[model samples]
Target: MKVVFFGRTSNGKSSVINAMLCDKVLPSGIGHTTNCFLRVEGTDGNESFLLTEGSEERKSIKTVNQLAHALHQDELLDAGSLVCVMWPKAKCALLRDDLVLVDSPGIDVTTELDSWIDKFCLDADVFVLVANSESTLMQTEKFFFHKVNERLSSPNIFILNNRWDASASEPEYMEEVRRQHMDRCSSFLVDELGVVDRAQASDRIFFVSAKEVLQARIQKAQGMPEAGGALAEGFQARMFEFQNFERRFEECISQSAVKTKFEQHTVRAKQISEALRLIMDSVHVATQEQRIHCMETREDRQDRMEFIDKQLDLLSMDCKAKIKKITEEVERQVSNAMAEEIRRLYVLVYKNELHRHIEEGLGRNMSERCSAGITNALQNTQTEMNEGLKPLLPAPVREQVDKLVPRQCFSLSYDLACDKLCSDFQEDIGFHFSMGWTMLVNRFLGPKNTRRALMGYNDQVPRPLALTPVSTSMPPFPQGSMTQEELMVSMVTGLASLTSRTSMGIIVVGGVIWKAVGWRLIALSVGMYGLMYVYERLTWTTKAKERAFKRQFVEYASEKLQLIVSYTGSNCSHQVQQELAGSFAGLCQQVDVTRQNLEEEISDMNNKIELLDTLQSKAKLLRNKAGWLDSELNMFTQQYLHQGR
Candidate 1:
């Protein structure tokens, strides 16, 4: 039977072992701590201690202090190290060949200590959890025991609440405190750790002062008075509980050998056999259900894919038709909307008596009014166009597109198309109005002063009369009359003056008209055949201007409608395609996962079913051996108890 002591730092785990041995064979103190695990057992003939560090040769030591020093030495102690102390049966009766005591270092000190404990302490027949009673079970203590309870094979756990002497001064308060600690530790072990039940755990709890016991034993060994000192008094007070614990621990260890190990192996083997059978059955059922589900999902996915494909096909076929229809609808709505907007803009422009501003210098007022009108028209058209297009799109597609295409999305699209149309119309109106306004201004203001003279402003100033010869001056004529030569020169000079004046007027007045409409007219003339040219030039009137306006409006509307159709159709189609692609990909991945999982589960179930027969045979063998051992141990227990009675 192997008993292991586990606790945190400075909790007197070494002291507890010393009390049990009734000898100072193990080091015990805060400064003289057990850094490594110390495994002590009784030797019948020779007493010896050996320290083993991994693959290194065992180093023999003669005394307990030397063993402690060697364990504490950094160079000597390697990973997974331990000190084995062998002593004569005279020193300690409990340290027999069959029973060994392992004193472990504080659990909170190092991480490697846990691995060390797990390596050597798994098959322990009994566990002594030496917890500090001055406080409740700490985090380290709970954690250490929680871990120990998992790996330990034995169920006989003894919880020693060490340092119980601290509470001796106040008996009533100490009892209350002890009760609280018991309740808390039990809760931790039972509820938190799930290692033991409340009733069984409460019985295993032993309150004793390990330090007092150690001191009492040491003084008694030194031939001093046993009951005189404070240590002896405390030890006497707590000795009964400690002795009771010892008796139970011994009884548990004796039972642990044949009944515990054999019965556990027997039960565990049977459980494995039963558990494997259940698992195989469950896996068979689950795999079959999963395979059926996969088939159903595959059919469902096919149906869904076909439906989606059909929808996409129909959408593609009707794509152009839908675009045309939607374009017409949008154009009609926008036209109606713009008509109202244009009328509103006209009303606003004409408001406050526009004819009044015309009289207030047409150049200045017309410039300001035209600029203000264009701005107002632009703003109002944008608002009206957006409102018109807003209802054209269904909410779902619109919302999706809104995220994809930012920057006022629908409004920006509507505005771009509407603005293009507005710009075309504005250009026609501006061109015609500028020509008409310039003509009207020049006619009213008399061709402007800049064009009235050829060279300078002093052109009308009279020059000094030129002197002539006596022969030419003989005849004094009337101021208005002239001879044959003078008459001819006067007529020729008047004709040249009239021609120059007419040419200057034509150049200034026809500037814009000649550049625009007049050039087109010239082109038509040059291109037309003989009689057709003459007829077109004669028939080309302002009626053609009306035709031009009608043509410009149609072209502008058509261009804008096509642009709106192209952009919106592409965006809507892309959004639909993306949504379909994502959904299709996800469904494909899910189907793959489901099918793969079902296959793997079926394969695993088939493999485990083959191992069931072997497990059954093993379980039968374990049960037979365990039964024979149990009977033998029962006879021994009866004999021992009867003799004691």
Candidate 2:
């Protein structure tokens, strides 16, 4: 509890506090000795110290003189600055009970009354206005309390008319003067400020000589009579009034301090405890709801994951079957296509004028066609497979699988040259007397019948006929004795031989026959047989060679395309399956991670709920305790008011 002294300068404001302390701990003089605000409070032990404003250094005050000197040194130029004087609680009864006395610089000295009040008087439990008893309350002193009344709610004020002992010089007017001061001070407090009623205001005002009280108290403490020399006539009565004022001041300050300071704090603590309890309860509920939500979400994810696993198994099986079927279909289609292309190879060779270098030009042409055909087939297959797999996958996985489709399943180092299909064809277009009879016979009979007979001869001539070897073993026969059949056999066998020496011998024999037969017979026979032999050989050889090439190329090309179909189809199928599987696997991993996170969140929420539960209980207990204390404080305030009345 703090009691602040406020009045005009030289009105003994510091002397009032010193008189209460019963020591000259504060610097008090006729001038404005209290330059700054000084707050005197009690310390725990005998250790008395002076704490200047904005300085931590403690100046020891072992005696009253030392304390006075310390206070004098701390006389700050600014009236708002404060110096705290700590005296031993054992020495002063008021200090021992937590009573702090603040002595301000004269109110009339500074125009900054608001700064002075805010700095020293706002929290003061009791304001003691030290008015000079020799004079009426000054406007500055009255105006100061008016401001205090505005800020504080019904502040407890005591008007101590100090230097009242001076009234003894005019003893005849003392009673009238006392009556005038009492009426005016009481009217100011009751009518003007309206802080209290006339009765309470009467009790608040006092006529006291602070100097006489201090002097008397000091002399008494030193084992001297309380009355000193040159005393006023009513000095004893004045001392009694001063003690009466101290008694009322103590009661008012203690009660006012409780109501003003502790009551507000008690109310605030009650509100805080209740607010904390409500907040803890709200947090606990929120955490429980969040934990439940996480659990439900985790359960839903688990169910989704199970469904995905089943779907993946089914998709895997279905994919394998589809791939197998597609591979077979590709092989069949590609093989048939290639076979048809090879069958038409002769058209490419013949129509494109590639007969001269048919092997190179036909190989290059077929290679380009094969590459384009196979590429188209594989690309189409890949597209179809991707489309088929897309519908089977989940939405998230499908998009990834679509993007992951292999661009090209088959990459070849070189084009399909169809090497075996472009083999060298033996072109034989030579004349023979063996075909001379067949030509003459074909002219009379139909061409089909002639072709049948020639085919029979063609088949036998290349075989090792026993009769042709017998000719070489037989005795030398004259050309004149030989029959036409025997001669024909000899000539045909000799012509069929590939050796140059045999062909040269056959040519010499034909020349000899020409010479014997004469020019007319040889020339007419040669002209007829030569034209027929040449025409028959050309047609037969060309047709036969074309048929043989087409047959061989078809077989070779079909085999090559079949191999390509198998490899490319299988590879594409595998890629599609891998893409699907990989996408599904990635999605599964994400789901698992989400589940893990949800589990952790649920666990965390559980812990938070538990913690909030504990805090809620503690806050509830604190709220109950504060409520009890607040009720008791209100009860005590009511009792005090009744007693004062």
Candidate 3:
């Protein structure tokens, strides 16, 4: 961890550092002196880098040319040389342990160096934006404050009120002056940066004269000068822990001096971590609406499949024309855009030729392979989208089918030749990353909607439905802890740094002796100072170099993780969609068969009942016929008897 210090041009950062170091390791007393950033560490010797040509390399100081805007990004041609600023290494201290405190180049009222210094400040773990007690929040201070606050959710922001000394004989004047200054500072911070609500602004802003404080501590320990008990009292309590200070007295005072230096550096690390956690928590809340929204899934849409594919085909063709336009523009601009590289015709031609080969020949050779990289990237993206939708699914289906995504997938590319070619159709320009095309073929193609979604952050969530592809051929940044083996490698690297600094210190000392001005004692002191300077410089440089390399390591790791997450999100989404479709089809089939069976059974039962009724009716008719015949015979007998009488 590193503790980086920044302030306005003439504030007292160098003075404060020297106070901690207990010696004027860094020469300070002029206008905007330390131009380029220099990393300092505790060491046993002195070394310095001189300004002129015929310059001899000394221990303790490194003076490189001011870093241009060119090297702001990770990739740079002179990155190796810039990484070499380190000094004054220490171990077994609370504040500055393995700490690289960057004394950034200060920006006055000028904007010339503002952007450059801004970059340096951004790189620090904690930002200590120094404000003077006199007219504390100046225009430049306000600007830097806003810039840092906007860009960084910082952990520790320290405002040091430098050069405050009150002689008791003039108590009234000093008290009034101090009170006014403190009140003004409080209001500025509260109104501008919002600090007053927490506590007293004066308490937060420590009033310390660096020169006086350093002198007080050294004299108090050595018994050379009277301790300004009043001044020393406040400085001791707030800036450093009393226990650590006392512990120093137990050890040899000289070693305690070094320990205090390192302790200050370490404190910033813990402060940064604390402040970051607070801000993250403030924004980290998962909203009820978000929870509801996040779980929501798009309806299981099927009809759009054919429609979408056809639309995409047309879009892809339209994309090709746009891509062709861009490629032509790119080709035209290539002469100017790549002019520097054009000097090396072979390398330039090689890259151009390779890109062309990939597009014209290899691209068509195996379409699957050509698009495989992107297809893989899309699947991973789909997984992320699925995750965001996970909570929104129905409870029953939520657990089982929540992660599903449509599997009909394709890859396409988009290209823009130049600005004018793209300006008219700017909306389409962001659509695809086209490799190249012939005069006739503008090449553009990719996965439709998912490409656009991955452009922002939070698009890479690890849910099954998350949709974002790892675009760009470059590798991603790494995250998480380093392996023990890797850590061991770093320790080895650190040991190497320690050795180099020690050796550098020795050479610087020897050089000072060789160029002795007068007495042997003076020469030796100069030699020793040179040695210490070199050692510190070496230590700081090695640390910076290590950090630069670590960045590369991190990116590589992240790329690998991105691929994994995207794949999981895609596969999960597809599986859920497929299962849902299958279930619906099965239910429809079941309902149709049941309906057919019921109709057949009703027809059979009706026919049987009608047949039984007909038989019963026939029986009744037969009985009635028998009765009629009997009645007719009886009537005929009665009529014959009446005539005989």
Candidate 4:
């Protein structure tokens, strides 16, 4: 695995490489500069070469003037391919692993006629394109994106905002510059994706003054060589600043994912809990005999109805309260945690630092172009609704609203927005609770065993009643077949038809009791009152039958109600799970895609940077040679003129 950078000419690729290496190997400059591919191989001891024509050649130091023609022709590269060369100083660094660094001639310098930057980019696992902060996301950069993207899927791309400090006064101030650059960088990303919000062409992007890191690294190395006092503190500060940026970014992403998952789970758990509670409340009031056993007249029935109604009201209220509590708990636990994390990140991580990270890590040309194009396209999308309408009725006579803005109202007003928002929330908040509460009501409301307690089912057997089971030979009810109503009716009928022999004994007793007139009169009065009491009790008994019938109807209705609520809630849960899954999956995919894009942007930026370095190195060598030649020419001309005189 290695990092290769490529981009438009003079995008500070040289400065990026030099900074990365903590050395001044490549001079950052403009124009036809790079002479050959300078391969920075990490250990692994893999031997390869840039053979002259066909034979193996030895690596040697050559002046820029000597390599000028091949640099222009790009001939040093054997048919323009990758050639590995080990970095002598970092030999120890390479022996452990393989992370080769390959630098190509600047895009502008690589054979003016034979262009193949896409090939270089395609070969790299991670392409890092470096662009200057001053002229980033230029038109030329856009072309580079088109070329490289044409070859392969850019999975791991990075963008390094090289020479980032050029835009600001101090290293501190560069953060703002990074933000501005990233905003433009984001545009390019939109362009590439062809979307308003999508992961651009890169995996990651970052804005760092590679120059600063390089300078800091160099200074630290110098400090190591020579004992320093204040330099140590400065070194510590730089390292801290760098690490802080990385930490904050990682923390933000981690916390965001946790918060999202937490909320999702909380909502689902509360729904299940509510369903269980609903089932419990409906079973508490029924008695062992499934009877109310009320010993009262018609007046009692009305009083009982009133009490039962209040009980229903209380149950309903309790269900509502329970739902509210669950919602509050979810909000308190999950939302609060998210808020606290956000606050912590804000205080510890600088906003500017985040922007810089984005710029450097995701500032690749392909990423920028993709993001920008997409954003522009979305923003440009415009169409008016085709439906035509006219008012149908006169406006309501208002006391206040009409005076403030008469004839300037629409249905989708601010008030409607508020209402709409509230309506949308009700579907979410009241969702499972409403179903569970209904199930509870259904389970209890009907005249089942529980309902008898409310409506008053009397378990009374009249004093004179005698049950006679006349089992017909043809057919007889099974043991538990007779309902309480059936048995009570049979007993009352038997008492009414009691034989004359049973009456003869009562008559004899009546005659004897009558002879003692005074005492008999007292007994007769008691008997007369008891007869009236029977009459009253019989009427109450008739009322109880009616109450029992009503309870039967209520029970049947409750059973149906129970079925409906249970079915509805169960169905709702299944559907909700499916919908939630779809929604969550889509969101997760979006996040992953966007993050990948940012990372790719970072890689591209890094690649482009290395290309710049190679160019600058070749150009600097030529520049020095030119100065030497010019000095020698001046000396020769002066001597010749003096001797002729």
User: Which candidate ranks first by TM-score, i.e. highest?
Assistant: 2
| Per-residue lDDT of model 4, residues 16-91, tens digit only | 6665556554444455354445555543334322334244664432332333333356544542554444443442
lDDT of 2 by residue, 53-150 (tens): 88899988787667666656653537788888888888787788888888888887788888877777778888888998888977888898999999
Ranking, lDDT, top scorer first: 2, 1, 3, 4
User: Top model by lDDT, which number?
Assistant: 2
Residue 486 lDDT (model 3): 43
**lDDT value for model 3:** 0.43
Candidate 3 per-residue lDDT, tens place, 1-645, comes to 445666776677776665665555454655335555545554433433222212344423333222222123224222112232334343213223544455655657346544644555555554455556555567777676767667655234556666554323455566686677667667666666773444745444556666665666567557765355455334553335323322332232333223333334334533554454443333233232332332231111122233334544454354444334433333333223232222222321222233343233322432333245434544544443344333333345446442233345443322212222212321111111122111112212122222322221233335354267766896764645667644544454454456565788667766786687656877688688677656655565545554534443333323332333333333433433343334323322332333343334334434433443443344334334334433443343345323333
Each model's lDDT comes to 0.59, 0.68, 0.43, 0.43
For model 3, the stretches where C-alpha displacement exceeds 4 angstroms are: 30-32, 42-85, 90-96, 166-170, 200-203, 220-645
Relative to the unseen true structure, what is the C-alpha lDDT of residue 458 in candidate 4, on a scale of 0 to 100? 57
TM-score of each: 0.41, 0.60, 0.31, 0.31
| Local accuracy of candidate 1 as per-residue lDDT tens digits, 462-497 | 644548644675785444544664344345445445
Question: Clashing residue pairs in candidate 2, if any?
Answer: none
| lDDT of model 2 at position 460 | 40
Residue pairs clashing in model 1 are none
Q: State the TM-score for model 3.
A: 0.31
